[model samples]
Target: MRVGIADTTFSRVNMGAIAVDELRKHASVAIERVTVPGIKDLPVACKKLIEERRCDIVMALGMPGGKDKDKICAHEASTGLIQCQLMTNTHIIEVFVHEDEAKDDRELAWLMEQRTREHAVNAVKLVLHPKDLERQAGTGQRQGFEDAGPARR
Candidate 1:
């Protein structure tokens, strides 16, 4: 599977590198990293990666919570906080399937979606430091959670 991982910064690209390495162990995977300049940098980068790299999936990674105790205190800490940590370091947005290609195999789309979801969720849990994320955004109440979106793709 050719996957394009997008992040605003090189840090996310680095994480994409790690995810790619891991995916290689289980399936055929290729990755391209894109960097943009600014808070809204990810969208364009994501588009470019999808078009240029022709990735099967795209994932957006972000550090939504801040990295300071004060930052964490800002959020309404709760068990079911639906917060999306923006990928300050890096993020994957979507998995791209060309219309021509997707039409060839519908199952591939499902599989790609599963893999994309898994990659995003797992990468966040395994790659990001829980303490740092919690302290940064003060989502302490939302700690030790698993969003196992898929059964390991």
Candidate 2:
């Protein structure tokens, strides 16, 4: 299977590369990588990777800025990604880390690394062992963080 990695160049973090490395450790698959200018470009990159590069799955990685406009752009990018997925009938795993999601830069960086790596594994599972994920459904497993079990009164 071929896994495509589409990442934004707007941020300094190298989450996409980390993801690819982690994926290599877990699954033996060919990788196609593309770096775009910003989050908005991820959808097009992913589409090209799928339609032209023949990737079975595309992992879209980006870190949005800490601003309302940035959030809006992220939303638009996400919508476009969904459209691309439908058009190609392929899975586009979105791994977005907003600058404001964490309390500080250090925390955000950690989250980005964790999320990206986890999503890469997820992409592999989606292609090769979907049943494994299906069995974990409702188990409250957050890819980057510890699982939060159901609350009981």
Candidate 3:
């Protein structure tokens, strides 16, 4: 089994590194990494990892800046990622941490790590043991912050 990680270089946090560590700790699968320049470049990189590198699953990690243009580009990049997933018939767990998510640097860093690591675990479950997901179904499982703990039971 193999997992792919497509990350961006423009991010302040090293989300790729965090993901690598988290994935390695949880799964024994081969990991493929592609570091792109920006959020917009992640789709092609993820496709390459899936098609060329033969990763069973992929995670697209990006941190878009807190600017108007940055937000627009992030949305465009997300759309492209969706298209890539449809074209390749692969699952891409998008872990996007917008800079505007937190005003404090410390909080932003925490959020980045929390989100990336959580998604990495999800990627592992998708390819390795999907039944784990079924167990958590409707449990309000969330990444990057406290889970809502299943909506109104």
Candidate 4:
């Protein structure tokens, strides 16, 4: 199966590289990469991969700036990704990291790698083994950080 990886040039770390690395661990899965200038462009890139390249699923990766306007754009981009998924009838795992998510560059890099890898796994399962994810439903699983779990009763 073909899995598309759509990342942005605005990212500080090479999230696409990490995702490709993690995805290569699995067998019989092909990866297609499309790098855009910013987050807002991801939806179209992902759609292209889905419709043109015939990807079974896609991972839309982006690093939005911490500014208010950037956050708004990220939300809009996320909505576009959702719409793209519905239109293509395929899964597009949206992996977005805000620039201010961590305190330092080192931590931020780690978070980006962690998040990308986690979502990479999700993308694989989404097509190859969706039942795997279904088994973990409602578990509060998180990417790039510790799992929150369900709020304590």
Candidate 5:
């Protein structure tokens, strides 16, 4: 199986590289990498990886700045990614880290690394062992965030 990794150059973080390393450790799959200029370019990059590179799955990683405009652009890019998935009939796992999600630059960087690596494993599971993901259904575990289960009274 082959996994495509698409990352943006807008941010300084090396999320794509971290994800590639994580995927290599977890699964025995080939990787195709594409680096675009910003989040707005992720959809096209992912599409190309799937259509031309023939990757089984694509991981789109990016860090949107902490601003309203940045959030809007991220939303648009996410919509485009969803459409690409439908068109190609393939999975494009989006792993976005917003600058505002954390308290400071150091925290944001840490979150980006953690989220990227986790999503890489998720991508591998999607391709090789989908049942592993299904087993967590209804557990209230959201990606990139702490699990939310029933609250004890």
Candidate 6:
């Protein structure tokens, strides 16, 4: 399998680099950096990677500042809802769960709210409880069964 890694900003290059490195251990991987200018670039790069490079899976990486260093997402937020308005070709896999609030289940609601502001459109808002999101949404499309699980716990 060929996996493509994308991170828009240099601030989180370490996180994306670690992910890309780990992915390369198991399959062919291509690492690309997209600019944060707009959502258009993400999908375009994703499409090119998939169609041109034949990347089987595209992993969009971002640093939402809540989770640990290396976590990535299928969606911009933790609710597992993909922000397609930004890019059609990209798939966001994992969101950062804030370390301080992750221990409290009640905070999931707030997390969802926070996620809304992180993206530009802020249109695709979803609940952030890991259990509910997983049970209800089925762990976001494109994730391996083992890879799809609770965000923090």
Q: Which is better, 3 or 5, measured by TM-score? A: 3
lDDT of 5 by residue, 29-104 (tens): 8999999999999999999999999999999999999999999999999999999999999999999999999998
Q: Tens-digit lDDT track for model 4 on 39-139? A: 99999999999999999999999999999999999999999999999999999999999998999999999999999999998888877888999998988
lDDT of each: 0.42, 0.91, 0.93, 0.92, 0.91, 0.40
Between candidates 5 and 6, the TM-score winner: 5
Model 5 misses residue 48 by how many Å? Answer: 0.4
CA shift at 8, candidate 1, in angstroms? 3.1
lDDT tens readout by residue for model 1, 3-102: 5665434221234444455555545456676644322444655556556676555564322222454234223221111121232233344332222323
What TM-score do all the candidates reach, one by one?
0.41, 0.96, 0.96, 0.96, 0.95, 0.40
> In terms of lDDT, which candidate is strongest?
3
- Model 6: clashing residue pairs? 66-98, 72-94, 73-92, 73-93, 73-94, 74-92, 74-93, 74-94, 75-92
Question: Residue 43 of model 1: what lDDT?
Answer: 63
Query: Model 4 has how many clashing residue pairs?
Result: 0
What is the clash tally of candidate 1?
25
> Which has the higher lDDT value, candidate number 1 or candidate number 3?
3
lDDT of 2 at 42: 96
Off by over 4 Å in 2: 151-153
Q: What value of lDDT does candidate 3 attain over all alpha carbons?
A: 0.93
Positional deviation of residue 130's Cα in model 4 after best superposition, in angstroms = 1.5
lDDT tens digits, residue span 1-153, model 6? 455544455232333455554554443434443334222245555556556666545554444444444234323333332443234443444333333444454454344334322321111222122353445464433221124443554
- Per-residue lDDT tens digits for candidate 2, residues 1-153, read 999999988966997789889999998899999999999999999999999999999999999999999999999999999999999999999999889888998888899999898889888888999999998777777767677865556
